[model samples]
Target: MQIISQVFQEISPADFFYRNKEIAGFSNPARAIFSAIRELIENSLDATEPFGILPDIYIRLSSTGETEEEGFYTLRVEDNGSGIPSEYIPLAFCQFLFSSKYKLKQTRGTFGLGGTMTILYGQITTNKPVEVLSSTGDSKIYGYRLMIDIERNQPIILEKKVYENDGQWHGTIVEVNLEGDYSKAKPKVIEYLKQTAIANPYANIMFVDPKGRLYKFERTVSVLPPQPKETLPHPHGVDVETIYRIIRVTKCKTLLDFMQEHFHRVGRQIAKSFLEFAGFPEDTDPKRLKPEEIVKLVQAMKSFNGFLPPDASCLSPLGEEILKAGIMKELEPEFAAVTQRKPSAYSGHPFIVEVGVAYGGKVPVRSDNDITLYRFANKIPLVYDESGDVSWKVIKSIDWRRYNVEPGMPIAIIVHICSTKIPWKTVGKEMIADRPEISREILNGVREVARKLKVYLSRKEKVKREKERLSVFLRYLPKIAEFSAKLAREEKVPDIKNLLRRVRRFGEG
Candidate 1:
């Protein structure tokens, strides 16, 4: 045998994703199908909700080549949203890292990596082209059939078409073919869609599974959460690299203007004071800062105490009212308590935590655990890796029994973390990192709702005791009334029914 030497070469983003697909949650056929559906739905949600459009998303999974190709499937997702422009269709669907989500905002995306990974994974698995059709409420409908050249990270368009539009329809539709084990992925895919419905009760989602079963999650609320606003980066969050990138494109000349323009809540005075504290000249050219000087600036910025904390304007948290409404509609829990924690920050990135507790009614009970914990980041459901999640860690540490909750009870807990940057444990975004600040907030929020649940449980227990007492009295009170009437010899029961009505009213109240 002849030995060969190793060679080094640069690889494109598409090629890297193709070789290391598991990093994007496409480890196997089952998971690939699930991830594909999830990515498209999330993309649709970002498009519609942020733009003030009530979303109507449709998904269909059908068999494509069942006999000839093992487990081959066709996945189609359509959304009534702000459609993409004709010129941007190729870049939006095929290009890697080309996105509007690279800024400081709360969105369910990863710099456009998630959607492209889905497209690339499908192309590789089935060797098939993708079809996309869209209209942005304009009078032109554009359609394209394309495939990605994985080696070069470019789109190879196979066909393009233009059609007459009625101007009444506005949305996008994407269809792709791939290999998947729908039977195996059914449970997870259904759970994801259900969880998504719980989080976004204002959106209507209809799904058709591979076996032609229909699942519908209809809107239970009429209002949507406030849209998240794009914000400036904070000084505490920036590093030398972040500064360098901004400086490359920034229009500001001097460092003083640069700080005030690029960082959140930085004023002219604060900028000057910070420069003085960092020992850098205030009039230094921002674009000309040396590497060593920029490093010092970053270190000084973190140590400075004059900067104000970041605000929650960049986060869109679901209000307690909306959360409770959704829980009631979906889980039908007899008791529910939800709390939207006040805004907090870490690494200069503002975040908010929302915790909800529900018990009894239709909430499923597991004989072994009897708990259903739903975790989310930036409104996207995290359906895997729960044991290592930050929220779950905080939950396990809490004394839930103090709040009249325990194992083997029909209970569900939802923890939602919305921030411009979620500290995820992995690149797949399945779990949250156990940051002290974020952990403390989760603990506090969960405890707040647990206290409310305790009150509800106490009242419910009192009502149950009252009902039992009323039952016993109703059984024996009639005998006492009959005996008294016979002894008095006047025969009428003396309207004992009125007394029973009063007792019932008192017991109920």
Candidate 2:
């Protein structure tokens, strides 16, 4: 018998993602279409939000064959956003893990993988190059037809051209061909768009589906959410590996300087205390520190009690006023309440939670629970994995009866979590992990909104009871007046209409 040898080889990012498309949320034809659209729209929103421009996004999905259920389809997404620079266009579309979002701030796409993965899926499925056209408020527009070299993880540009522009329009347009099941994906796609409108009432979105149906969600508000500011990482969130990497790249010469400069809430005094606790000299060069010393430093940072929680400047939550307006405008609920919790942190990442509860009117009441929950992370809607998300767990644990919510009640629960780093359970980004801190924030936020909803519902019930009592009293009041007038033998009957009017006014008041 002969012995066999095992062979191992490293693959490029594109190749790895192509082999495992499901990890990027492109599990099937239907999901692929939804994921592609979602990624593109999210990028558009991110670009527009920074400039405080009201987002105007256009999407077109058309099938090449007679029917959308089979064969290939072309998807084009265009946005009025701050377009990508001509030099970075190819890398922006084809390269993986190349992102300006590496800074510590709240953003929709964290890994810089969503948009690239979308194009990769399209390339693998249909063997077609993607078309990209962009103008960054420049005198000319740049266009390119590109494909990703999976083995090399680089962009293969097939065609490039420049067109003279008026320098007025600044936006990007991307078109790709992919094999997808649009008919099946239609519901989720529409739902995602609708929920996006509800969350971002300042955006105007239009879509033309494969069936040539036009769907548009117009902006209801003009104001946009505050942009998140970049922040430093907190000490508790850093690990041994992270510290090693920081030490290697940090500009600070000494360990104390490195600590004070890199980590949030760490000052000169705190850095000195940390160094003393780690048994390292304050002037010791961080680069020359031994591996054991690094471990000790990490441990000391974790155990230090004086370090303040992570800086919350990096988080941008939807304020209560904006959130409530969006919910009211979209859901048309008779009663709506919204709450934005104070900034909090998990490990070293700052986060904020916003919750809204809408009741009655167009808010659908599910048959099983009479409750509908909408979950969002960093303004991007989470359309799938409801049961697995932390928000869902918190929602299920809440006692709805306490809020006067019952079976078949038309109620919708909205939860939004914004953070520098969201705790996602899977690479799909469809579900948030059930971290204790995140769960606690969600619970408190939802409870606050629910309490307000309870008050509204309670007052409504009270008014309803008052109306019923007024109706009964009005009906019997006329009878009593007639009887008294007859007993007194009056020629003209007592006029009860005036009394009824007075009573009605009192009831209304």
The local distance difference test score of each candidate is 0.88, 0.88
TM-score, cand. 2 vs. native: 0.95
Q: How well is each residue in 1-509 modelled by candidate 1, as lDDT tens digits? A: 88798899999988888898898889999999899999999989988998899889999999887462378988999999998999888888898877878878899995578888888988998899889999888998899998998889888889999988886678899998888888888889998998898889899999998778999999988899998888999889988888888989999989889989989999999998899999989889988888898899999999999998999898899888888887887888888899999898998989999999999888888667846788989888999888899988988888878988878888888899999999987667799999899999999998898899889888988999999989998998999999898999966877789899999999999
Highest TM-score scorer: 2
- Please report how far candidate 2 places residue 125 from its true position, in Å: 1.7
RMSD of each: 2.8, 2.0
lDDT of 2 by residue, 80-114 (tens): 99999988999999998877688888888889789
Q: Candidates' TM-scores?
A: 0.93, 0.95
Clashes of each: 0, 0
Error of 1 at 244 (Å): 1.1
